[model samples]
Target chain A: MKFKQYLPASSSDGKAMVSLKDGGTLGDLLDTLGIPPDVPKLVIINGISRGVSNTVNAETLTDGDVVAIFPPSGGG
Target chain B: MEAWMGKILRVNLSYGDYHIEEIDPDYLRPYLGGRGLGSKILYDEVDPQVDPFSPENKLIFMTGPLTGTGAPCSSRYMVITKSPLSGTIACSNSGGFFGPELKFAGYDGIIFEGVADEPVYLWINDDEVEIRSAAEFWGKTTHETEDFIRAKIENKYLAKEIRVASIGPAGEKLSRIACVINDKNRAAGRSGVGAVMGSKKLKAIAVRGTGKIMLPDKEAFHKAVLHARDVIRAGPVTGEALPAYGTAVLVNIINEAKILPTNNWQVTYFETANKIAGETIAETILKRPKGCFACPIACGRLTEISDPQNTGMGSPKYFKGEGPEYETVELMGASCGIDNLAAITKANYLCNEMGMDTISAAATVATAMELYEKGYLPEKDLGLKANFGNADALIILTEKMGKREGIGDIMAEGGYRLAEQYGHPELFMGVKKLEAPAYDPRGVQSMGLQYATSNRGACHVRGYAIANEILGVHVKTDPLITEGKAEMVKTFQDITAVIDSSGLCLFVALATNFLYEEIQSLINAASGAGYTVDELVSIGERISNLERLFNLKAGLTKADDTLPKRLLEEPGGPKGDVCRLNEMLPEYYQLRGWDENGVPTTDKLSGLGLQ
Candidate 1:
């Protein structure tokens, strides 16, 4: 049911990845991955900022989806 | 008075009165300055029961003895006060020409007390200081407010460069994470101190001073400085990695190490981290190396992004500014699920210009995005569909939050409060109510403990375990194991307090001579004080205890020092990695010689010269 997977920037070309389950929002994917209800994850998709529960358009997964992700954060 | 301006200025907004008080040598010698001095003042002067945002809560902007001395990174200073976000002692340090300028202006610190009945700006010209009405400058952005103040002063020559620390509409509107930005974009951008300043009706503070500074031993000082300069230039991390790419380079490094937390910390890897990496950011937007006063490292980046969509007065790259450093990239880009170079750069610029803490604001928006995706908040409530990965919404929310308007209003409450308000308390990924920085706890185990006990909430700069976990600066360690991290964390915490209070940038931690023979050489040559490596290291320990004292006085208990539930419970990131905070906390307390509850015993405090 997972839609599209995103590889890590440091990955050798393409390896490590993250994906949202099909027809699932980001939060639901979190449940599937066992991410805590209160744990915060910063989600960046297509240069736009959103979080878990961000709906996954499965059809658009392999299209022009240039996404990034980071943990809850602060500037070092 | 030979080495110090020897006076602290106290401005009482509640009474519309101001006074100059002499700084005692007793306080100076014991606490040193910067965060150390600021901590002592807060511990002694502030009442624990007082509300952080109330006029009674004092915001102290303090510089150190070495500040303005042309010492490496001497341009640093810190703003210490009760933080609106964390409800603990918050000390957010910044670097630029401002700290030095404040020192030159014949003062050790500015102690802001009480709340102003109306908007105003503080004007300090050498010894002549005044509180001027700033109603005209109210709601203006930081750059504009500073520019307008100098215009009003009519000092002509000094007006153009009169260093100003100003708050924007975010502060004026009382955004909990609003920042006080100075020297264009060098910001003390954490913990909502700007909102506290704004609560005092203070728009900006303009300073121009020409007083010459006298060091304890000028000859020795120069020699030490020269030695440190060599250490910096020859050092691998400082000489090349930073000078070339800045902190943004960490994106690739950490991501490669598999500790780069992405998607609000739900994951430990960001596939597109390299897209907005330091090297790429430099190639695309970095114009030149920018520097703070006396800092040769010039780790700061001055950039110009040419994206037509992001071009305008609000964008930093529209003209130029300090940065979209690593943390900003993580917070504004990776944290929010945004992978666009121009978009994150634009948000970084806007945050700086509008006087906002990029970390908290990004985390807030990211939290809102998470919440919005969870159905806890509706698009109708936010006036827009703020689902995760909405780059435009992230940017717009950044702007709104900076102004404390629209959706920005809710986002600006910071991640913890915002999530709590939405009846989804567990979604807040913070320690001490301060939002966590990048680097998932699971992937980098020690980082979890580091964030848990950071003096200013969930900050990584306080004791970045990444040096060991990812970069292997000290030694390589399993990022997933909590085994011996307690001792390492305590050692770093102690040494960091020393370095931070000494007015040195943490990049020194990356210096090849991290053992500090070079710094030892510098200290001996300049101050004429023959200090061994052991003695020098002790300074860090001393400073750490002092900061702990301040936090203790502010009512932080061992219980208050903890990681968020997600890190502890969620097993999503790297293999079987959960925040081993509890595993390390007790050991950390033991290593710190504190009680089981993380409280510093009277004996331990006195042992460190708190006596």
Candidate 2:
């Protein structure tokens, strides 16, 4: 999973994608990466915005699920 | 009293007469200067039915109380007038040394009225204010005008202390989308305020002041300003992200969220959004970063594009300038389906040099591209193929728009007018004839309500509901939902009104995790005005209601407060969503104490002391 550096618990370099265990839920992946489940304002898995109902934290991640996490930052 | 200069400079261009007037305390109390004071004065003095270009229309330059007070990011000034483009009340603010210089010159604001027989510019050296002929500078670009004025004012031996606010050829031609450029790059860049200046034949206002700005409680003011700076520094957005990537950081984020408004908003996202993203710009064209007066976070991108061939663009093999801000990148690059960052950068430079609004100009071009793609516009008429992703054509079209030559005459009229001229009013994609910003309402649901009801005609800066809806600055809200957005929009609008008047950058209000109390403390300490946090919030609401009243009087009905049909009806993004404006507008009106028709009730006006 690629994380924007601004997000909490993301790698300092913001480019490393860690391999996760098979059938690991998104929460387990976040826990492995030390990211709090509630930190990201919006999470995208392969370009679609996942609502809270379909949050990455609860959804199980497959082998090739690419994730992008965003923080609460703004500009016009 | 200490924060405000407590005076106004009134200039009549027709008579070439200038006078200084003591600002009424009552006027300053409720309005509180800046946008609030400027809007109140515009509503009071100008007839709503008068043409925007007529001599009867007044142009007011206003600064906030914190301006020139050494407050962090406190160098913003507003240009308020009736917009020739949108026919709505226009208040566009710019940040540079000009605001502080005006305050230091012992005036809180300047009100320009009547029309000049010939081109002229205002020169202020302390109290010696004079109306000088600008016949020699009639055709100069904004950068040239500033350089010429500065050179004419000061000797090379002395330091450059003068600051200027000037218009360019775009303004000289009275393009409806012209902007007033300050410090060469920063602009009061919306609502055709520059056209208002051009109609009056005013070239620029150059000011030099050595006078000091006094703060009532200097210690408290210092403490408050320091604390505010600290708060800004502590935030992740203001402290780190902005300095690193500037505003262009949002390109990927918005694209990721699928709300980037690509190709005249026909789609929600662009395919090559990453090419023009902040990270890309930082890695490629960005040379350095800059900031306005006393700004702690330098979010301004001072960039250069040296590879024209690689950029796939026009003249200027090596270009150097500021910005191509997030809005500029989106509207000029992705929104037009031209992902060439250099092309967008060049377009941005043209807009700055020619004193044009990037959003308006680019959106207009995007609309033209859409028209051309649909066979409504012929390549023969355009002199070039304006197909989507035509980088070279984007550069040429931008230059033509700035010069207002050939087909650029129609293009210069702005997106709403351009779309209407092409026989497609519904394709305008704005409220009250003003073009929408980079955000697509179908994606960020609350932004639809914000743009629909904004007094300034489809401006995101008016409310910035994106703070809650997208960025979650204050709190996270479901971007796809309509519930609770009404209350959120109202609160954001009111708070934004306060911030706009308070002489602080809106970024502070957005990025800083604080409330009205800290802002009130800063204002009270600086001005010795005994205003509580609640009073400040009420004043914000009052200013908002006053602006709403102006728009209402100007013939903006509830019907005018609506999104484009596409947003209201069509599917958006991969999720196939649509803006629930109907679901939200009624709740928004109710929360605002407005009638079902969107007019504020008499009691609501009375409660705000606006009646």
Candidate 3:
């Protein structure tokens, strides 16, 4: 899993890969990592937004699933 | 014209007559310049009830005291008018060589009043202002118009260095989303400012000068400039990230927050954000980084798409141009659900050429796509399918919007009118007829209030609360809560008003380490207008109040200061799913010292020296 620049600095470093169980939901991983679930953030699994097959936080993560998290930022 | 060129050029195109007049120093002291001065002029000279396109309407292009003073990012000018789209006081700021050139040409600003009897373009060559017939250059694109006028000047000495501000076919056709573009890409890109120029049959403003600005305190100004540069260079965003990725650096960041506004605001996240993100552009398409005048933080992206299939121009194997910045990427890419960066880039190029506002243009198309998907709009009427994720459709629609051809005629009116025409006005993701730029208000809750109350209508720069709520640029606040947002929004809006009026890019204040004190010092040193931080803040407040007064007098009531129905009702992202606009607006009005109707009280006006 990779945390993008927008993630809270205290939560996780973008440089390291974290290990997780097979079939673990994104919410489960976030809970285990002590990441806040109620905040506005995007969950991408294996290069796709997590909502394609299931709710963003409930999407099942399998072996080798690449996950990344980011926060909101936009202006012209 | 001395110190700061205390002169303004008044051109009455109706009679092809113009005169240079001195601006009162008394007025200059209170209003400063740029947005503040422009707003004061508009409020005083033009009647609030007049039709925006009427001869009674006037367009003012004003620069600030710091402009042409070699201050960082000081190449800024403002175009102020009543918007044909929003029916509000509109002031659009642009950064390029034009503002500085105009300053060097011995004037602080130019005011265009009354419609022209024929097409004309203004030529300002160091005090010799001429309203030249523009019949030959009337139909040219902004780039071509600039080239044409620059080449037509009789003065051989300064012809090569002339700078131009122009409108293209979109503006010529009176498209409400049309913008005034300068220096190839930079634009006064909101509120139909270009259409105002077109209404007067003004093709462009060409300027050339050899005059030098005499700073009030040369040594102090230079020292402040250097300090400002150092401050920006030390900030993470201004020093590194922005230079590396341009404004698109926010693509993934915004998407990660699930506030990227995809599929016409129906979806909050886009799956292909990375493909059209800043990092991707830098790694693949970017040719080089560019910057505005005297700017050390070069965040402008210069790009080229090499694939022939991607360049909408059939035979062209490559296309090079200036941006599809974050707002363009989101509005033209994510909001339209077209993830193809090449198509978005092409659309961006077309917008620049057409002198159109990309945000409103894309928002117009996005609204149509929703109507099309819901079967409210038929293909027979559209001339093409506009399904979400259709990159080709995005390009086609953009070209159509620019030319105002076929169905483009209606779309050119902007999102509000387009949606209202289709009997689904609720589908229009906008406030006061102006489409909100990239950010989803449901994710960044404060932006909801900011957009609703923005004097120019749904603009981000008016009060970019996103910096605090999301990026933590100034102070980190809980994005999901409405608590303290009203006060935060008021502060940001006031400070931003100061920056906008000061002839400096707002990005420096938001993305760089240079804040209020540094900006105050720079303005003081350059213009010799010694002002405390509190006084600067008061000027910003006064400007905001004046704009509000105009809007109110023009008939916008408290009821008009609200977010779109969809954003207020629909669920969005994982956080507090809907925008808390109601909870914030009241608090915002209170903090602004306005009544429950969002009207500034006489006492408050008196306090700000407005009474």
Candidate 4:
């Protein structure tokens, strides 16, 4: 998986390359990266928002998916 | 009379006289204040086709009822006038201490009509008001003008309390992109409002007040305010990201999304965007985060540029100021393909000091660079290498634009005129003649519709679809799809109108819990208007239609409500998509109760009480 992390508190640097087990969910990736569960984040997989909700963890991740995680941020 | 000061000061600069008028309570219920009330007044008084710089074009400075009421982020003020750049009704909003001060001075707004025979500044100390000759302050920069005015106030304590909103050399030179700078750095920073101020020969308005705004129900208002503040503090975007990184934090996120417009919309991503991102600013130049009055977010950046090599001729070697905000960094840095943070910050300081809108100034420079590269513009015209990524050229051209010197005279007219002069008006990436902000609309579908239909021209803040499309503020939508975008854009535009009218910073919307209900509660508690959420939203719709009527009367046609040719045809996104504006426009018009040609229907107007 190709991971892009915008949260400074994340264990991984800005961009990271990680190999996830088959049938791994987004929560697994978060766990591998040491991202805390309580932290608010907006996750996007292939430009679609996997919103920061309880159901987000159950959303299965696929191989080669571009997972971009950002802490709550906005601009005009 | 509870929240509103219930009085407006009208100054006839031509006659050097002023009058105070009472604001009807009925009007307050419908129009609210700030942009809504100000736009209603401008539409009623000024001829739609009046020359923006003519004496007939009145300039209004307005504040909302929530302003100075100890409400969160209640520092906003609106500058309403005819736009010299777009020939449309311009309502530029700004935040700082100025608006609250005006409210405390016993007026909801100030309207300046006609041209002054000589340069002058308005000095308001509580109820006392004067139009004093500003001949000595005519040539001063905004910062210097504020300092000079304060020094002349006599009472040091009173002077310290003074808040000044003034234009600099750019406005004095009638630069169409000139903006009014307040509190040293914050600006009413679009649509040439400052040019209108300069046209009237008005130098500045320095105000100091030792009064308080009366809230009808202090207990209820305090409760509502506490809840609102709690919502803001609880949201990660408003409470953490913004306060920690400032608005420029969007740099990396936008760049990562491949939607950050680069090289003046020729591309959608900047490779070196991280170098100028908020993190970099925090690590390098950021002194601290600043906040407007009663603001909990505090997204404003207090920065310093210490590099002597970054300074241009006639500029200080070391300087401190606010911003290089997201728009500034994007337009001046990435849009020009220049990654030098110090150089970008220096240019930002110059734009602020000289009182120019950074978006238009940099976008115009970028257009000039494109024209120069294409051989459409001659090198002899600029007398410098106007190439992409040339930091020195950016700095020099920005200074010249502010001063209206050399080719910057043409540039001061803005990007559209600059490109048209060079035989390629298609190259100007803007809508309604105003340069587009940082986002490449192709990447975010609803933003395309927002830009095309924005009453004030190409403004992102009118309806920031990115919040939904990218940040998932309200609802996350697929950025590349056009489905349901019309409704989304319309909804955002209406809510934003209400927010702008309420004297509250729009950043409050970033908070997950701060929605229509929160806004309604605040308004009801403070103003005693007792408007339901639906009523408040209808007020926004009314404001929108009224501004649209003004624009339509000002000679804007359906043709003017469009993105530039580049955005319409060019594939500038990660997925090589263009803005499918056609799919959304018809739906948007339908949603807005407008006819096929984007004009509001008689029934709609009547329903909104505009008829």
Rank ordering of all candidates by DockQ, starting from the highest: 4, 2, 3, 1
State the C-alpha lDDT per candidate: 0.75, 0.85, 0.84, 0.89
True contacts kept of 3: 0.15
TM-score of each: 0.86, 0.94, 0.91, 0.96
Question: Which residue pairs overlap in candidate 2's backbone?
Answer: none
lDDT computed for candidate 3: 0.84
**Model 4, range B80-110, lDDT digits (tens) per residue?**
9999999999999999999999998999999
Model 1: chain B TM-score vs. truth? Answer: 0.95
Clashing pairs in 3: A42-B256, A73-B254
Q: Which stretches in model 4 have alpha-carbon errors above 4 Å?
A: A1-13, A22-25, A37-40, A46-50, A53-65, B311-315
Each prediction's DockQ?
A: 0.04, 0.33, 0.13, 0.41
Query: Which residue segments of model 3 deviate by more than 4 Å?
Result: A1-17, A20-75, B1-3, B154-157, B312-315
In angstroms, give how far residue B506 of model 2 lies from its true place. 0.5
True contacts kept of each: 0.03, 0.35, 0.15, 0.52
RMSD to the native, candidate 1?
Answer: 9.8
Model 2, runs deviating above 4 Å: A1-23, A30-42, A45-59, A62-66, B157-159, B308-317
Q: Judged by DockQ cut-offs, is candidate 3 incorrect, acceptable, medium or high?
A: incorrect
Considering only chain B, report the TM-score of each candidate against the true chain B.
0.95, 0.98, 0.98, 0.99
lDDT of 2 by residue, B1-611 (tens): 88999999999999999899998898789988899999999999998767999999999999999988887789889999998998889999999789999999899999999999999999998888999999998988998898888777546532387888999999989999999999989999999999999999999998888888888778888999999889888776787778888998889778877888988888987878889988889888989999999998888999987775433223446668898899999999988998889878888988998999999999889888998899888889899899889988788888899899988998889888888888887777778888888888888888999999888878889888776666666666778888888988888889888888988888887565656876787788899998888888898899888888877787778888998998899898546789889999999899889999989999999999888
Q: Please, what's the RMSD in Å of model 2?
A: 3.1
lDDT of 4 by residue, A6-63 (tens): 2335334366677789999888887877777655477767645556776887788888
* Every model: Cα RMSD to truth: 9.8, 3.1, 5.5, 2.4
